[model samples]
Target: MKDVYITRISKFLPNAPVGNDEMESILGQINGKPSRAKRVVLRNNGIKERYYAINSQGEITHTNAELTKEAITKLFDDSFTQNNMELLCCGTSSPDQLLPSHAVMVHGLLANKNLEVNSASGICCAGMSSLKFGFLSVKSENSNNAVCTGSERSSTRMMASMFNEEAESLSSLEDQPIIAFKKEFLRWMLSDGAGAMLLENKKNETGLSLKIDWMEAYSFAYELETCMYSGGEKQEDGSIKPWTEYSSKQWLEDSIFSVKQDVKILEEHVISKGVESLEMVFEKYSKDPSDIDYFLPHISSNYFAEKLKTGIKEKGLKIPESSWFTNLSSVGNVGSASIYLMLEELVHSGRLKKGDKILLSVPESGRFSYAYAHLTVC
Candidate 1:
């Protein structure tokens, strides 16, 4: 197979940056009361401001497809446009509707002639999955070029209205006046944005391009239960009861459709599994961690930053703090869009030089999966 390169990267963050204090105002209060977990979650996530598709009035300014379109549009210029794009791959955790696939909706928004479209569905690693599809397609000579996008219009899901029914139901029972931390904690953590990248068989002639050295993903679902999820409830047996299994009334009462995380599972498995996955990838490729010039990790919260460092170091990959790059503090956790956003910023930061090696790591708490990629500056 031939080599592939990322020729261009772009991102779109909807609306103005909403500060920590402005989140509750934009998302509104659940049960007409402020979130008890908001402050704690925000403090741990270390996000000062984040973008949201929802305006202050709670009106949605853009859907997930629209966000993906906007970012993809930014990838083109007079020399390259939608007419030249041969393949499109979109990934996301939050799509506007359940019926149409997210990539088709984005293709509809772009109004481009039909070519090939694929959608990768999951949490954060979904973005990397799309990138991998594009890279492999170009590498195998199946496509001349591919446009890959990762986006989330999650603000709509995080709105107070989504949880008000469940919170009210809990209040009525009086056994618990608030929703569980598993359901409410994510409200403060996730934001909205979209990012797109162009992949081609040849590197750019005039500017820098990221040569795709390798990309690999691993899943431990057989060895672990779900740790983060939405549109489902975690049962006592550690299995998920899908949204379809619940009645509409039950959906509203239990917030079965709201995003939730089994924090205990997350705390116990995420870092350790991530380290093990990375070690396997490194061994497979005979890669040495000390050769990395930049390390970009999609960490959901700053709380895990040091823990991830310790875990990886114990495994012999000791990337220093100065070599690390992340925009999470400013952009918040955009889920599937995060790694794309971080890569976009780094590519445009004017810091890359020839022969530089960049390492990307995205750990998905959704059933404990991880994706790692190595790129070289050309």
Candidate 2:
């Protein structure tokens, strides 16, 4: 087997940065009333600005595939272009359509020659899953190089129109009605963006490259219920009733297709389960947490940043706050693309040095899944 390295990284955030006060103007108000939870959500998430693929007029400027293609295009120069790509892997929780795979859609936009393509579907961890696939492919010598992408066009689904039906339905039963906090809260939390990375067996000659030391993933679905999801409803028994099981009209009335989260479950288990997974990975790989120079964690909200540090410290992993880095406050939460975006920024930040060790952590609340990876600067 051969070693794998991330040779290049790029990201694309659509349109201009939308400020905190501008979100309602862009997404519009549900039932002609501004969200009551918007201020609190934005404050807790600590996101002052974010990008949206949709304009103030609610016109879509780019699709998920288009965003992915734009990020991938930025990865190439005169020396490396689409013609040189051998394998393509795309991961996203949001896709333009449900028929064709996301990778094929991105490939169609690139208009490149035929190559091995794969798509990974899930929530935040989807990006890391794509990276894992590319890492293994290059490590096993099955592919000389691979282009991996993670993106999300979440604005299309977060529009107020998507939930108007549900808001109206609830209004009929009560004097003053608002959509559930679980669904309304995410509107202010998510944004639109795409990120891409190039993985190869050899490190870059001129600039810094991230050598993939190891990757690990774990799922607690058997012990936990779904916490964050879309196109389905969580039953009282902790099982999900898929969108297909609901009537067409019920889908709109309940906003069944819109993303929702069990905030209570997320707050209780997200950090604890992540620490458990990190412990397992450290034990299996004989990794020492104190050796990490930088720790990049994909946190959906800033509220959990300190909580994660506390939880991990209790487990004997003592990564200090100064060593932690994140761009969530500036870019907002991009779901599956967040880790990629964070990594892209760090790679270009001019802070890395030879022999530096970076640790990545991505926790997906979609049935409680976690992915961790270690990289070394070379």
Candidate 3:
């Protein structure tokens, strides 16, 4: 099969950067008292700033479709938006709606701009799995050119609406703030962002391209279990409440992108799986640790930094501190949009030179999935 190259990548963050202090002010306090969730999350996650698609009143200002539209438009240069755009693959942790798929909605927006893509596909919550789909599409010759996007707009609305002191009445826990923060800490760590990459088959174009050397993905769900999940907990019979049977209040409690996670499982397994997967991918491509010129990682929390560094070294791959670059501390974890955003920052920073190899890792607690991609600048 011919190699796939990422010809161009464009990343976007809605509104301005929301600093930790400012975000705390916006989230306000729960139960009319000082809540330490925001402060502690900022300290532990190392997320100093993030973007939110919110209005002046701090309400959700952009839907998933609107965010996707802004991202697609920002990256759509006339030179690349030719009729050759054969496939569109959209990936996100949240969608504007369940029916009609987010990819189709993006396609509709593209069509309005006269950018007609023939086939559209998506994985609603697989994170980097969605971009891998587009990569495979072009590499497998199913499409000559493709566009893949990872967009997210999850914010504090859901977290505040469902976990406030009033809502805590539903729970029998004593420390409501701590319990609520534990359940939906993602509200602070996750922010709004969209990133898109244009992929094409081997070509002698005038644009820059990152040649794909090899890519691999794995799931450690067996060991990780459901560390992170959406929706309400399942009942005794293992059935979720149907939407039709939901009261407006119950609906808000269940349907939001408000995440439920097991912190112990995530901290224990995220880095181990990442190192194991990187080892396998490196061996598969005959790549040694010394050969990697750059390291791009999408980490879930800043708390895992030391563990990731030590764990990977323990596994025999040593990444230099200078070669490591990530936007997590500044942009926060935009979920699936993270890897592309990190790559975009690195690329535009003029740090990479020709022939330099980039080793990228994306770890997701959703089903505890991890993926590695080895790329070379052409």
Candidate order by decreasing TM-score: 2, 1, 3
In model 3, what lDDT does residue 270 have? 72
Q: How far is candidate 2 from the true structure (C-alpha RMSD, Å)?
A: 0.9
Deviation (Å) of 115 in candidate 1: 0.5
TM-score against native, each model? 0.98, 0.99, 0.88
Candidate 1: misplaced stretches above 4 Å? Answer: none
Cα error of candidate 1 at position 164, Å: 1.6
lDDT of 3 by residue, 119-202 (tens): 222222344666677778788988887788888877744445555644455445455435354465766778888888877897
Candidate 2, run of 10 with poorest lDDT: 314-323
Give per-residue CA lDDT, model 2, range 1-378, as digits (tens): 999999999999999999999999989999999889998998789998899999877789999999999999999998888999999999999999997999999999999898999999999999999999999999999999999999999998999999989989999999898899989889999999999999999999998999999999999999998999999999999899999999999999999989999999999899999999989998899887888899999999999988998898888887766779899999999999999999999989999999999999999999999999999999
**Lowest lDDT 10-residue stretch of candidate 3:** 116-125
Q: Decide which is better by lDDT, 1 or 2.
A: 2
Instruction: Give the clashing pairs for model 1.
Output: none
The TM-score of predicted model 1 comes to: 0.98
